[model samples]
Structures are given as C-alpha cells and as structure tokens.
Target chain A: MASDQKVLELNDLNVHYFTPRGAVIAVNHVNLYVKKGEIVGLVGESGCGKTTVAMSTLQMVSAPGRIVGGEIKIEGQNIVNLPEKELRKLRWSKLALIPQGAMNSLNPVTKIKEQMADGITAHEKISGAALRDKVLKLLNDVGLPERVYNMFPHELSGGMKQRVCIAMAVALNPAVIIADEPTSALDVIVQRVVAQTLLDVKNRLGVSMIMIGHDMGLLAQMVDRVAVMYAGNLVEVGPVGSIFEHPYHPYTQLLIDAIPSTKQKKPLKVTEGLTHDLRNPPPGCCFQFRCPFVRDACRQKPPEFKQMEPDHFVACVQYN
Target chain B: MGGLTRGYFIQRLLMFFLTIWIGVSLTFAIPRLSGSDPTTAMLLTMMNARGYVENADKIIAAYKESFGLNDPIGIQYIRYLWNVIHFDYGFSFAKFPAAAWSLVTPALPWTLGLLTVASVLSFIFGVTVGSLMGWRKTPRWLNNILPVSLTFTSIPYFMFGILLISIVAFKLHWLPATGGYSRDVNPGWNAPFIKDVLAHAIMPLISIVITSMGGWALGMRGLMIGVNNEDYFLLAQAKGLSPARVFFRYGIRNAILPALTAFALGIGSLIGGSILVEYIFAYPGTGYTLYRAIQEQDYTVIQTITNLIIIITATGVLILDLLYPLIDPRITYKKSVAS
Candidate 1:
C-alpha cells in the first residue's frame, strides 16, 4: 500500500524474445511490487510469461531474449542498463534466485558446501573457517544435516536438493529472492515439506520474495499476494484472499475453476481456444478471443486494471 | 555418493588384467596361425634368395630346438604368456640375438614424448577454442573466426604431416626433413641437443596439433552449447560470480567431462596411430622401429611392439575408469546406488 515500504518493484517491465521469425512479447508492461517481509505469487499456465518476469527481474534472460523496456528496482536501485561490473555486485547480495529444476540446479561436480559457499564468497569476501561456519549454518537452517555439506547433488534426494536451493537463496540475505516454481519438480509429500521450509525461512528472515509457480493449491498456502497473468498480461493483482475468493478477470476465474478439488468431484474445466500467436497478439484485450463475455469494446481496445476494492485490482471490461 | 568402493577397485583391476591377457593371447595365436615356425620361414626365404643352401634342413632343425619352436603348442603358449608377463620377448629374428625388449625400450621414450605432448597441446588449444565458439557470451569476432580453425579437422593428420614436410622441410628448407635431430647434436638433456630435438620436432608437432585440435574444438563446442543451457550454468550466471569463474568452474568444468574421456581414449592408441607420421619423418620412435621390423620380417620385434601397444591402451582405459568419479561426481563406482 506504501511505495516507501516497497522492497522490490517492476515498473512497466517489458521483455521480448527476438527469434528469426519475429519478436514475441514475453512480459508486457507489467508493474508489480513486493513489500518488505511478504511473499507474492506469480501464477499462470505454461508459456504465460511468469518465468520470463522472474528472469527479467534478475536481468538474466539469455541470448535472443532481451529486456526491451522497463526498470527492475531493488531497494530503489534500478537494475536495468546497469554496467556488468555493478550488476554483478547487486546480484546475490541484493537479489537472489532459487531457480526451477532443483534436479539440475546444482553443479554436479561440486560438493554442496562449495556450491553454497562460492555464492557467498562471490558477493562478500569470506573464506576458510569463517566461510565454512557460515555455510554449515545455512545447511542447518534448511533442515539438512551437517553431513549434506560434503555430498554431491546425485547423492541427495530430490526434496533435499530443493531444500539446499532454498538455503542458497537465503545465503546472502538478499532483499528479494525470485523462486521460480520452487516446488514444481517435487512429489506431493516432499512439496509440503519444502513449502514449509520456504515459509519458515521467510518468517525468520522477513525477506520479500516473488514466488513463480503454476500450482495454485501450493501457492494458496504460502503467498500473501497473488498476481494472475495470461497471454503475457497481468489480469489481476491483489490480496491472495481477494483473488481466490472473488476472481475478477474471466481467465482468473477459469484458472481457479480448473484446480482439482477433493470434496466436490467436477469435470475438469478447460477453455476451448488456444492463445493467439505471441508474435501477433490481437490489438484488443489479450483474452478477447477466449473471454466468454467478449464485447465490441473488448474487441476494439484493451482494458486496464481498475481498483475494485482497497488493495485489489482487476483488468477487464466488466470490472471497468 | 561417498566414493569408490574397494570392491569396485578390485573389479576394475581384474578387468584390466583380463584385457591384457586377451591381447597377449591374440598376438601369440596370430603367429602360430600362419602355419610355419619362424626357423622354417627363414630357411625357406634363404633358399629362395640363393636357389640353394648346404645342409638347410639340419640348420633349421638346430635353430628350432635352440629357439624352443620345437615344443608343443600348449607348452609354447604358456611359456610365451610367462615371458610377456615379464616383458621378455626373447630375440629379434632378423637382427639375430638382439633382445626384442632392448630394441623396444629405446624407442618407447621418443614415441611417448612426441604423442603425449602433441595430444595434450591439441586438447588444451582445441577445447579452449571450441568452448569459446559454443558459448553465447563469446565475442562476435571470435565465433565468426573459430569455424575457420575446424577446416583443418577434415584433413587427415598424416596427410597434414606430409604436406608440412614437403612445404616447410624439403621445399622451404626451414627444418630437417628426416630425422629426430641433427647428427652432430649428441642426444642428451643439454641445451644444444634439446634445441636440435625440438627444432626437428617442430614440423611433426605442427602437423599433429593443427590437424587434431580442431576435433577437440568441435567436440568441446557441442558440449559447451549443452552446458550453456543447463540450469547450473544459468544459476552460475545469476549468482553474480565473475565471468571467468563461471566459465571455468561451472561452464567448461562440467562440459569437459565427456571430452576428457574421449581424450583418454585418443591417448590409448596414440603410438599405434603415429606410425605414418613417424615413417614420414623417419623419427626414431617405436612407430618407426615397428615399421622397419615389419619390412624386415622381424617377428619378435613386431610382436613386442604390439604387446606394448595393448598394455598402454589398457592402462589408459583403466586409469580413466578409476578417475571418472573424481572428474564428474555423478559418475561413481559405488554399489547399491545412493539416491
């Protein structure tokens, strides 16, 4: 609610992947913010640009993918266009990443201790016993045993690897940690344990985070705020309660409906149409082709988010 | 995993010995399979040369007895295996009474010095170039120019050696065309001898390195491309470590595992493959010695060289198998498999 309290801000962030065919807009003018000591979930289907947003925030989109516009401000410092030397300093210290694919996130050739310690040493200059003590403490914090320090990634279970990533994310005490699908690759039982570890780490450290995942059920338990995205557009950004209880956008409503429920057996809800070619998105609303309540106004022009209630915003003609 | 187990070590060692035994057995069988003892083959050749020989049959029988060729096949095989175990390949038939091991031992160092140095140099140079070419972060000028180096890969190395000898040695007269060193420089570790040896080695070294490095580059380039896309590589960049650190520790370090295995296999046949190069330059290496032995029908010397090659190759494979876990932690010799 307060700009001064914002720990991380994405202002008009836009990213485009320039393929030989054409430029595909991956993240489009999205503005999101994470306040101190809160977790925000970025939710969408596959290819909806949730991961793109996280990667762009870290300034790490590889070749052929460019952050064409906008600023990623961490602690009021704009990360875009920062020189490589300065950017290196800001990374891990100010912003860290808990990458997806916990299975392969670790360097297979290195020990867990080296993998975790090098990131700290890269940001700060600590070595020898002092560095060793810091890394051991990190392992302890993640509910991993001290013996895990010497083990390789192949030696650890998938869940343990995920926990190690969580520990690494918090290693530098970064202001914001972008965890892309932190629990996507784990099984249900391990997912709960990892999710709990994430919550525990956040509670103890009070660091802001942007958690990227497609699992609505898991996100509902961990995040304080939710940002719903579709076709590279943020359809709704509000309190998790508001987004889950009364989804404003048509797509958001469909997403909530699609989640499998234990108590009530229902036919799985799936939309009939596919997203338009990202290279040539329609001129009007991104969801115009798929929206059940499409109108002439929706066909001619895109709608912007309006404040439906305090701390609640939705982008749709009906909301307007 | 914790590490290689004792059981795994013993298993690999047994496999190593098995390979050597098989190789030695094949060498022994091939000579016998020709269906004539060395003594009889030599006498037959002598008769063909002069059209007559006085007491040829008596001489052949006496030679076979002395050489132990008169023994039964089973006894000879066991005896040959025992001798090979101690590296004792009795005598060169053409160069009478010259111990086969003595001839081979003198030539081993030259082959080792040349091939080991050349392959290692080629690997380092090619891998460095290939990794740069494969990496997206490499400068545009580099990626553009790196492919030109691979043009040499299509040229067989021995052909390249011949070309170098003609152009740089015989034509240009910049280096000696046919020898390990000049006759005047005594073959020792002193400055003059070392200088002469290196000067004579330059053309051969150039031919081997320039032609073979491209293969390493191409292999490493493909590997680096795969490594570039890996999650650990991306995370390495995200961690904000210096570019050099990321490239060496995370990028090349992981990608080079498969390349190292290939390199070791390359070294296994190093000496055997260099015969043509050695013949072209008349270098005093085992390859040259083996070539001359084949021309002169030196059975014991040829057999000794073949056995040495097998031993060297098997040793290379054995060392690679044991060190694989150390280079790539994912590959382990442990049993029961850790999670």
Candidate 2:
C-alpha cells in the first residue's frame, strides 16, 4: 500500500496575484499528483501559471501573490496552511526544489562545499569531518569531482551548477522535488545531460519529481507522465506515451505539433484565438475561445475533467 | 586563491603606485601654474604689512637661490618628490621656524581618533538598518519605524551638530561647549583626559552618525532590494535555510559588494575629516586645522594636508581593488589566461 501511495497531491489548488485593479487568478482550481518514485512533467506556455503552481506547492508564493485555496499534501500531510516553523521543517526534509535558472540559482560569493553543507546543517546535527564527508559524497553522487568542493558557483559551469542543485535537492531525500523549468536556461547538449542527471537521481533515490517546462521534446524523453496546463488550468494529464500519441486537448495537440524534429520540416501551429483574461474567466469551457470545435453548448458552463480512458483525463465540452 | 591571481596582484600593485604618482604630480603642477612662488607670496604679504621695501628683486633672487627655486623645473620636481616621501617639509609659512610636520602632527591624532570611531559606527548602523529595511522578512512595525528614524538625514549634519551644541551644551550645560578636551584635564594617557575627550566627542559623533548613516542605509537598501529579487536569494529560502542564515550569508554577503566601494569613499572623507562639523564643534581635528590654514593663507600646511588626503584616498581605493576579488569571485577575470 505504501509503495503505491501518492507522494505529492495538489487538490483543487488555486493561486491568485493581488493587483491594484483586481486579483488575477494565476492558478485556477488545478488538481495533479506525483506518485512514489514518479517524475511528472508539467508543460505549459510561458506565463501560463505553471510556475505559480510550483510556488503554491512549496507554500512560497511571494507577496502580491497568495495561495487562496488548496491542499498541498506531501506524504499525506497537508501543508497549505501549515505554520512557518512547520513549513520550514517540511521543506528540504520532505519537499526539495531544483529551482529554475540553474545559472543563477547558486549564491555567487559562497564556496560550493559550504553552500551544499549549510542546507544539511540547517536540518541536522552533522559538523566538521562528517559534514565535509557528506558534502563530498553528495558531489561524488552527482558525478562532480572532489576538487569542486572548494570552488565557488562562478567557477563551475552551468551544467555543473544544475547538477549541484540536483545534488542539493536530494540531500535530505525529500518526498517531492518541484523542478521549475530546470532546463529552460541551458543549451541543448547540457540540457540533455542535466535531464539525464535528474532521471539518474530519481532512479537512484526513488524520489518523486514535478519537472516544469515548455519543451515538449525534453519532457517526452524524461518524464513518465505529462501534465499540460493552459492559462492556469490543468487541461490534460495522462501517461506520457499515450498523451503524445493521442493528445485529446486541442492545445496539447498544438503543443506537440510544434515540437521540432530532424526528419521533416513542419509549420509551427498557431492557435486560433487568445487566452481569456484570468481576472474574470468567461462562463464556459476555458478552451472555447481557442478550441477548433467551439459550439454554443461549450459556452453554457465551464467544463470539468471527464475521464477519457484508463489513467487519462481531459477537460472539454466534447469529452463531456 | 580567492581569485587574487598573481598577475592581478602585480597589476593592482602597479596601479596603486600609478594613482599616487599622478595625484602627487598634479599637486606639484597646480601651485607652479598659479605663478606664485613661496618667496613672492611671502614678499607680497610683507609689503601689505609694512607698506614699503628696498631691493625687493634682489631679496627675491637671494631667497630663490637659497631655496633651490633657481634650479631646473625637472630637478626641483624630483627634489620635491623626494622631500614629500621623507616628510621633510621645511617649516610652516604662518608659524616660521616650526616644521611643517610639527604643525600637522598634533592635529592628526585628534582627527584620526574621532573620525575613525564615528565612521565605523556610522557604517555598522547604516548596514544593519539598511539590510533590515531591504529584507522582506523584517517585521512590519520595524520597517515602518525605520524611515522615521532617518528624519535627521533630512537636516544637514552640520546643522544637526549646531542643534546638539545649542541644546546639549549651551542651553542644558550638559557638556563642554568646544575644544578637543577640557582645559582642566592634562593631555596624557590618564582616565580623566580620556573621559573628557570621549565626553566632548559624543555630540560630534552623534551628529555625524545620525545625519550621514542615512545615505549608507539608503544605498544598502537599494542593493539589498535588488539582491532580494535574485534567483539565488529565492532559492536560498526554498532550501529551507533559516531566516538568519539566508539574510546574512546569501543576502548581505552579495549586496555588500557595491556598498564596499561606497565605503572606500567614506574612508577617504574619514581621513580628511568633516570640516563643517569640526568647525562647528571646535573639535581641533584635521578638518578644523585645514580650515584655519585656509583662513591664514598658510600654503605649507594646506599643501601638506591636501597631499595627505589625496594619498589616503588613493590608498583606500587601492585596498578595495585588491580586496574585491576576495569578496566577489566574479572579479577574478584577469584576461591573462583563457577566461
């Protein structure tokens, strides 16, 4: 039972950003999960609120933005309204982060060993030789040389720094690691290496992960399941292979078609219409504005998730 | 190595001397360009004093020969350079027969002692207040209250000094009105003398710290705010580092880099001392001495003091340049090897 239990769950999660004029619903009533040892890729366009979901899961949506409603459960423990101290305890030890922009994720002035060690000491009571040995072992686990322990962030290349982040995330063997677009800033070659490192770490540690990105191709190679978001809504989620083969959502199809290939040239799919304003989403299926099969019935009420097949789900009027 | 590569070290060392050389050479040229020889300046003052003189040209020629003013400009410059290095300034112009070094030596201790304490105190208070104001985690009440405390910054420092002198010294009779120390206490390493000096220092110290620290606070706040938005800062928080660790190691450590450059400029002015504050309190520091020298047209004291200030400022910047690579690893790019 424990083996198959979900490690992380976002139940009807909602994030809103407070603005002077009105509150912008950044992440609307989203539901997703990462089962034990699973790596689920959260793919979406830029500013579609995938990042807001990640931050909400971490209970770290900065001011001007707040988690209005949701239950974020890690190992079945709800952390949405958890106190600051309890939240700190839950972090790293239960929920780690491989943050985006690995190029700047590391503190520039601090040495690598200390940066790696400080996080460990924050939760545990290891010091001196033991701490040094732990940090060195982490570096080795991430395939970094022993010499890297003495270097600063600037001394290490971008890929190596991302690996350091990967190593840091697993320091406490957290239940879930939300890697927010971890490969966005890297080049193609290093992106593959870093993606492989994440998978390797997942395989070795049996830790669950939520890899957020816009690169459909990269996610296909790495993630077990794909969770696609559009304008803060979870449009589709299913096993990665089936979703790529039979993407039910029109936006998901467009996203998949836009993926580059060496075999043939393809026109980039331009969606039909713009995303409706988040502050006041219209009373209808969210995809009605852009869906090719928009009908009068689609505008009657907002569509809820309709089970399309085993382990696959879609939110659209046609599916309903 | 802390990024202080050997080549960079050598380069910095050369730059240090180059700055001093350029500054000293400018000091040399400016006086000559004004076309007022010391002997001529002296003669003109004498003429103003007595209203007549005989064989002024012959006297000027004799004085020039004795002072080596008749020598080639290049030779005189080299000789002057040699003299400055050794502190062999002959005598004060206003107080003849008294060495130039002697005129400045007594004031040096008072100025250095007061300004060092005040400047250091100001820097610490400013950094703490600034880092707090910059930090998002700081308590709302404290943040709201901090700006109110900076009200003194709106009032000029010397004006604040005058206010303190009027209220604390003149009106309430709480401390002495002026001077480095009480006239009653003998100048020595005694408790009474030290106490008197410290007591007299409080007003000036408060005025300087209160009025000037706002700038450091404002500058640091901006830097901290900028650093607050850095991905590293947010990641540090996500790493579950305690507020203290994240605030200090990640926040201040990076934000303090640009502030260090500003601090070096503070050190420059520290050595020169605050002329207005010193004059206001009659603190008998270098600033007050320089002010008196200006008033008296004492060229020897003024030139010596100005040259000292320039050297000190150059040294401060040089020290900062050398220390930068240690504090900021990104500054280590020397371009000698592959970047």
Candidate 3:
C-alpha cells in the first residue's frame, strides 16, 4: 500500500543557476518524496544537483540560484512561495540541514552549548537552566558528553565537531533532517561512528531524513530508499534493496557495478565519457551520450519517469 | 591564567618594554644628529630680530652650559633618557622662559579630549552601519552610500578640516572657528567654560570623525561581506536563525574582529594628531604646539612631545595585544606538544 503521509514532497522541482555563462539548469523537473520516518538517500556524483535539491528543500539556495518553478511541500504546506519570516520558523524546527564540512559549518567563536541553544531558543522561550538542560539533552542524544557544552569549535576534534552539528540539527526536534555528506571529511572509523550516531538519533526521534552522498555503498547500508541521479536528472529510485539488487536504469547499473564488492572477485568497472556540461546540456536523455543502451528515440527528447514496479521509478525511453 | 595563555602574556610584556626602549632611544638620537645647536639658533633668530648681536655671545654660552649642550653626544643621550624617566625635558625655547613640561602638559588634555571621543564615536557608528550594509543585499539606491563613504575617506584629513571650517565655521556660522575656549571665558570647571572648549573642538573633531569613520565603514563592510559568505553563515540561516540574529550574532561578531584590530593599530595615528586641522583651528593641541616648536627651533619641546606620542602609541599596541586573547579564545600562544 502507498503511504499518503509524507514529511517532504518535491513536485516537478526545477532550480536554475544564473551564471555568466547563462542560466544553467541545476535541477530539471525532478520529483522526489520522503514518507514519515523514512530515510531517503540522494546518491549522485558531484555537480549532479544532489546538494542543490537538498538546499532547495529548505529554500536555502543563495543568490544567482533560484527555484524558478516547482512546489516544495513540507507536511503538505507548499514552501516555494513562503514568506521569509514564515520560512525561518519552518527551518531548524521543522526542516534542518546538517551541512557538509561539519567542522567548519559551526561558528568557531561560539561554544557548543550556546550555538545549539541558539536554534532552540529562536522559536521557544527557554532560559537559564531549561536552556542548558535542553542543549545537554540533545548533545547526549547524539552520543556526545556534557563536557562539550563549554568548548569552542576549535577545541573539539573533527568527529566531535560533526557530532555537535548533528546535535544542533535535531535540537528543535525537526520533522525532517537533511544530512549532506555528513561523514565525508572524517576518518573511516570516525565516519562509521558519526554515521551510526546520526542513524541512532533519527531512529530515536522518528524523524524523516534525506541523506545526500556520492557513496552509494554507505547509503545502501543506511537508507531505506535511494534515489540515484545523473546530470541533474533522477535516473532511478526505489527501495534500497531493489535499487541495489535490480537497478533498472543503465546509470544506476553502472554505479552499482563500479562499487568494489567482496562477493565478486572481478575488477572494478569504470564508466566512460564526461558528464554533460550544466551550462549547455544536450537535449533528450541526460545520460544518452554515455548510456550503453541508447536508442534513436532517446535523442528526440528527455525521457519521462515511468513506473517499472509497485514502488520503483525510472526515467528512460527503454522503460517506457 | 592557564599555562597556554601565560606564554602569550609574557611575550607581550617583553614586547611592550622593547618597543618603548627603541622609541625613546630614537627620539633622543634624532635631534642631536640633525646638526643644529638649539641655543645658538634661538639666539641668532631672536637676537637678530631684536638687533642685539653685541650680547649674543655671552647669552649663547650661558644657555648652552645650562642646557648641557656641551656634553658628549652619548652622555647627553643617557642624561636625556634619565630625564624622560623622571618626566623632565629642560625648557621651551619657543615659549622663552617656560619649561617644556608646562607647554606640553597643558596642550595634552585638549588633544586627548577631542581625538578619543571622536574615534570612539566614529567606530561605533561606522561599524553598525557598515555591518548592516554588508548583511543585506540592499537596493541599488542604498548602495550609493558606499561611493559617498569612499569619497569622504579619499579626501586628505586636513583638507576636509579646512573645507568644514570654511563652510560650517566661516560661512554658516554654525560653530566657533578657532581656539580651545573663548578668550572671554576663564579656565575653570564651570558649565560655560566647558561648553566653550567643546565648541572650539567641533571643527577638528568633525574633520577626524568624518575621514576616519568613512575608512572604518568601508573596511567593516568588506569584512562583513566576506564573512556573510562563509559556510557557517549559510548553515546558520539553514538552522532557521532569524535574519536579525544571524546578522548580529554571526555576521557582525566575526566581521568586527578586523575592525577592532584596525582601530587599535589606528591609535598611533591619533596620537600624532590631525596636524593641519589643529593648525587651522588654532586649537592648543600637541600638533599645534609641535608646529610652533618646529618653526621656532624649540628642540626641547619638540623632543619631549615626539617621545610622548611614541610612548602612548606603544601603550596602545600593548593594550591591543592583551585584548586579542580576551575577545577571541582561539588565539592561544601555547606550542603544541609532540606526542
């Protein structure tokens, strides 16, 4: 049965970056949805609009980048045209972002406790003991000790800093959290610790998450569903198990094949051809140039998303 | 204090004395090396004007002996250094029979009163406005304020002073033109005397404030713009911080650090005074006193005032060094211990 409850819904989302080279379509007619308590992973190579989609969800995209079209509904409320004052209330309390480079994302001059409390006290009236208690509780939730409260950002190690970011992200008990490459900058062991901590926090709170990363292997282990993107298009999306086991799109198949595995004693497969330039993207399927199963019809126009199974979707002419 | 900070404290303490020593030594040496006997020059100029050359030889000999001018250069340097420690600088040739201390001390308060108040006002006003300009992507009309600030800062300080005086003082008659206080008002703690002193300070204060405030405003705006683009700022916005909170807590807080440094380093320039402004306003600040000292060959008064300026500037640097650790906790002086 399809769930009607969705924590976030991106309907025909189109985001463009107006640069000196002209308007580059960063996200083109992309549609994605995250149901309540679901962890959706947006996996793609760099410059594939993975981060842009996440930032657009919170309406946090900076200048020269505009969501020219599309509707972003959080809990069924369209946030595309929301006023700044109203948008601020939705941020952190309803939709928070665990930005990349967790260490540098924090204000270096502020203490961990104070920075965390800033998010809490923004929409609520909590002071003194109550504020400290709330911040400490959230820190404890993220597997950080209370000693981190008084410490400045520079005093904390990279993993500890990432933990503080996680704590800050969930400080207001937001309904949805977007963790963008949260563990990219950490050591292998520390990355596992931080990743596990994020999962524990999300599971404990029962909040939906959109984890964006290029490491499909890590995403497969962590997310319930995964959306694979290529050249600013959602090439394939389905349950993590099916997406990993039976990828329908050629791009998805190539990505999974490229990942190193212990079960297969074969060498890693490398895909050929450069990704289409965002400033001057070719017509028809974005993956047509690099696709192994490219057809004459694929050159006519970009393919629309077609349902291959009950819950799986793929954008390719062959699927249609 | 913690062990890490103790190193910083000790380092700054040593620097404070080192700077003062070098400053004082240079002041003592420069005047002697400039190749002119102060007493003889004074006698030549004053006596020549008065047509009293017959008695000039005796007076010059007596003046040199009294002023210790015949001593060896190195010995004089030592004696002068000792005199600085004791706050003694012989006598003022320009003021005839008056001691150098009497001329410098009276003028010190006027300059301090004007420059200190003006600098503080400029910093507060400039930083607040500049940060606002930086945080918001204002309309095209609002950005016009930046070019105006550039224009004000580009004008030389003294020229700005003269222009302000010509318009506001001479033509507009909105304020007094010259002097620390009206000649009619007696020097005292009374309201009228205080009012008169402040009235005379207006033109010079305006000159300093207008020029410096522009520079500080432009500098702060640049810093704020850079800081606003930092990843942390974007994260702060994403975390749902209010625009006002984000602007103040994150934007200004980081942006103001560079402004604070600029302000501290700028203290040395303040001690030098708005020289031409003081001369034009005829304000009895050290700049005007130094001007008269130069014209009249008053070497004692010149040496004393220059050393005073240097000492105050060195003290300002020491204060700034100490202030860094307090305002920013990241500036630790401790060396990392190798594991």
Candidate 4:
C-alpha cells in the first residue's frame, strides 16, 4: 500500500438498493484500493455486491439504488459528491468501464465506428475525419481488423464484440478502467486471448484496472492482487500469490480449493450450501452460515476486517 | 434480395385475396342468417296494417328484382366479388345518386387526417413521459400525474368525443360542430377549403388525443421499466453516459420496439375505431358514411365499404410486417437468414 502508487481508493463504502420489501444493503463497509499499473480482482459469486461496487465507483447505479456511505477517491479527487456534469467530464477522460455482456453493449442499429465516436464525443469536441482516424487506431490497437468499423453489432461474433467493448473503454486513455467479467461469455481460447489482450493493453498504456470476475483461476492469471468477496463482504484481500498459496479466510481457502487441477485425478471440491441471501444476512459474519468452522462467538457480532500480515487482510474472528 | 422481396410480395397478395373472400362471405351470410328478410317483413307489416295486400306484393317483387335477391348465394357472392375487384360499386340506396365508394371516399381523408395525426402525437408524448418516469427509479412529483393520465385512457372514446364536442363545439363555439368543411366553400384542393376541413377536425382530434394518449404513456412506461432492467442499459450507464442519453437512446430505443408493434396494429384497425368518433363529430369520414348506409339497409354500399376496409387493413398489416426487418435486423422473414 504505497501512498504514491495508489490510483484509486475506496473507504468504508456501503451501497443499498431500496426494494418494495425494504432496503437491502448490497455492499457493506467495504474498503479497498488499486495502485497504478495493477489489476485488483474483485472475486465473488453472483449477488455478492461485486458488480454493485464496480457500478458505484462510476456513479452508474440506477433508481432505488444509492451509495449510502463511502468515499471514492480517484487520483486524490473524491468523486462521490462531484456533480453529474463535473463527474461526466472525468469519465472516459479519467475513468472508464468495460461492462458485462459484450453482445448487447453496442447499439445494434449503429456501426462499431459510430459507437466509438459516441464515446469520444461524450468528453471531447472532435468529429468527422479526425474522429474516424482516432476510431480506426483504437480498433487496430485492440487487435481488431479495420473492417470492423463498418460492421453493425449483430454482424460481429461474441469475442469480437468483447474486443470492441474493450476498444471503446480504452478509447479515451483513462487512468483507471473497470472491467466487469470481461471474459465470462467467451470460449476458453477466446478467454485466454482476451485476458492476454487486457494485460497487453495495460502494459502498452500503463493504465490501472479493477477486474471483477468469479473465476479465481482466471483472476490468478490476469490480476496482480485478488479480493475475495462472500455475501456482501470482502472475506480476504492480498497479493494473488499470497491469497492463492496461503489463504487465511476459510471462504478464500474454499474458493482456491474449488479450482480444478490438471495433476489431481480426483474431482474438484465443491462448497456446500447456497450463497446467503442478502435480504436477511446472518447476525454476525455474512458467511457464518456457510463456513465449516462457525462457532458461538461467530454469531454474536460481525468480525471487523483485520490485517493478518503486512499486505494480507481477512474479515473472520477465526483469524484472531 | 430480389428473391426475398418477390416472396414477400407474393405472400402479401395471397393474404389480401383471403381477407376479401372472408369479408364478402361474412357480409352475405350475416344478413341472411339474421333470419328475417327486411323487404318481406316490411311488406307483411304493411299488409297487416290494412294497406293494400296486392300493392304490397307488387312492391316486394320489384324490390327483390332490383336487388337480384332471387339469385343463388354463390352467384350473388361472385357478382359482389367481381364488382369489388372492378371498383364499380353501384349507386348507394341511402344516397340514391352517389356511388358507394364516392360517398365513402370523401370522408376517408378527413378521418385519416384527424386520427393519424392525433394518434402519432399522443404516442410520441406518451413515450417521452413514460421513458423519463421509468428511467428515474424513484417516485417523483411527475409520477403522481400518471393516474390522471390513466383515467383519461380508461374513458371510452365516444363519451370523450361527446364531452369535447359539447364543451368546445357547442358551449365555447370554438370549432365547427359537423361536416368536414363549410358549405360556403367548394370542396376543392385549396387553402380555404383545407382550413375549413381542419377547423371541422378539431373536436375529433381532441377526443382522440385525450382518450388514446394515456395507453401509450402506460405502455411506454411499462416497456421502459423492463428495458431499464436489461444489462446493456446498466452497461451504458457504467460507461458514464448521461442519464438523458442513456434513458432516451438506450432505454427508449429498446422499450419503443414493443410500442411500435402496437402502432402497427393500430394502423391496421384505424378505420374500425374511427366509426364512433366520426359519427359523433359529423366529420363526414368513412365511418359516418358507412353508418348511414347501414341504417338505410343499403346492402350494396355496405358490402363495398366492408371490402374496402378489409383491403386497406390487409395492406397496412403487410406494410407493418415489412417494416419490422428495417427497424430491427434481428427479425428476419426466414429462420435460415442471419439477422
């Protein structure tokens, strides 16, 4: 956690969605940070508030959703309170997002070039030939053929659309890019290519990124650090090597053990029980119901996040 | 491309013929199956009233001869179909000197002008309002206005038409009460005639707008609610799009597709709904003329106008089907074709 290396920081962030029944806290008192030229992976099952955190970073949460409490600072400027007009100026120019489901990301009626142009025009004043040249360069940089510019979204394959999304996300050269499950829909080979392309883009542009995905194996290959999330809480956070090799939290251990190994002849281990419902989470630790070593004390009160090592943090009373 | 276009044309033509056949069969059978011959029944009643029975018989015979009522049903159907195909509908019994088509044709433009313009305006307004309300997520002051709009939509068109005519045409004297244009002006393609026709159209337009705008609002709002839940719209927001751009461009574009289908169906049935509005306003549209023909028991006029409505509606549906491919490429004529 070098202060000079930090690019984005989240302090005590909480997000809630107002439903007909009641307000459900999706992200609760989460604290994390990303450094320049680093990939911080937010790994969790569906509805664990991983995507909500990514969306909240950009102030993109829709109605009935609010960031109840938190401070989100990008390059030392707190953006949570920034007016929409000012925030839009920072977006694409300072921060960008690679959203999920690449197939539906681009408008079907519009060509790829025009979609790129829209991203450019949102924060800049360039158009016409100059815009066309810039868009062509972006496509080329993303390893896509120049002909992709003239093709509609429907004409492109899933992998190509994902690449186009990446191209648009990086078109403005933002300092931090958040990719939400960038390779979820792609095939294994395409996933590898997309993963490598992401790292290649990072190396070439020197942009920091927060990549959110559920596959720890994929994250191990692509991210510099991994943050394990379970039931709306960050169960473990540390460098990818440490979290993978010496996982402290029981949830992180289960996730790492769940990954299939080529050397092992036995079937991969599967964690028992469904994810805890966020509506009425357990009284203490959010994952206490699912943890194998849950005790009486674990149900008394939620465990506060404790730094077990210089860079490794885990939120479990067992760590004490 | 040429093959596809030709196939589409052929399909539409087949559908058109089928529609006409159905309309003709219904017109013939409905009148007969109702189980009482108007001429025979009227003649019997006249005889029972102490009128000359011999004179009544002679009158009934002449009426039957003039209408070719003694011919077989199949022969009568063939003659009806032939006259429709040739566009030679005979003079209306209700308007003795005027051809049925001629009687209905003059009214067609007024109905089309009033209803089409009002419907389009209401649809656009409703879609805009609905999209904004659905996209914002939280309930605002504007959400309270939706119930009133729904109330307007729930009211029947004719009742609203009468109410509007009463207030605006009778009480305020702000618009013409009846007829497409003033009698002082010749019905010509001129500015004065056009102005007079539009003045007569005002009441019908208000009625249609008030009665129909609510459905569009509710429909578009519901669609926007669904579209807002789509992953792509959230993606657009994640890309840092302004709320306006995201709602209008992404959310509305997707939501409006369902509304487009509604619009297409409306175009096909436009004449059907215009009947009551046209009659109440006395705006001399196809509906009003058809109503008069029915009241006078003019079978020739009724049959011809029914055939015309079927043909127009069939053509409208064909056009709507064709437009789907252009609006959304994902919809294709053949399953084998790529979107």
Q: State each model's TM-score restricted to chain B.
A: 0.93, 0.95, 0.89, 0.83
lDDT tens readout by residue for model 1, B193-223: 9998889888888888899899899899999
DockQ of 4: 0.40
* Model 3: pairs clashing at backbone N, Cα or C within 3 Å: none
User: A1-320 in candidate 2: lDDT tens per residue?
Assistant: 11568999999998999998799989999999889988899999988999899888988898999998879888888998898988888888988888888889999998999889888999999999999998898889888999899988877889999999999999989989999999888999999888888888889999989999999998999898899999899999998999999999888998999898889999876456888888898888877788778899889997879788778999877778
Q: Could you tell me which residue pairs clash in candidate 1?
A: none
- For each candidate, the alpha-carbon lDDT, in order, equals 0.89, 0.88, 0.84, 0.80
In model 4, the Cα lDDT at residue A215 comes to 91
Q: Residues A27-127, candidate 4: write the lDDT tens digits.
A: 98899999988889999888889999998898877657899998999998889978878887888788888878867777765577877887788888898
Give per-residue CA lDDT, model 3, range A1-320, as digits (tens): 22459979999999999999899989988889999888999998888999999989989887789999989999999999798889988899899989898668888777777788888888789999999988888888888888888888888888989999998888888888999999999988999999999989888888899999988888888999999888788989899998887899998998888877778776544357788788888888899888888899998898888888768999999977
Give stretches of model 2 more than 4 Å off.
Answer: A1-3, B1-9, B333-339
Model 2 residue A164 CA deviation in Å: 0.7
As for candidate 2, its clashing pairs are none
Residue B4, model 3: lDDT of 36
Q: Lowest-lDDT window of 10 residues in candidate 3 chain B? A: B1-10
User: What ranking emerges by lDDT with the best candidate at the front?
Assistant: 1, 2, 3, 4
**Which candidate number would show the highest DockQ if scored against the true structure?**
1
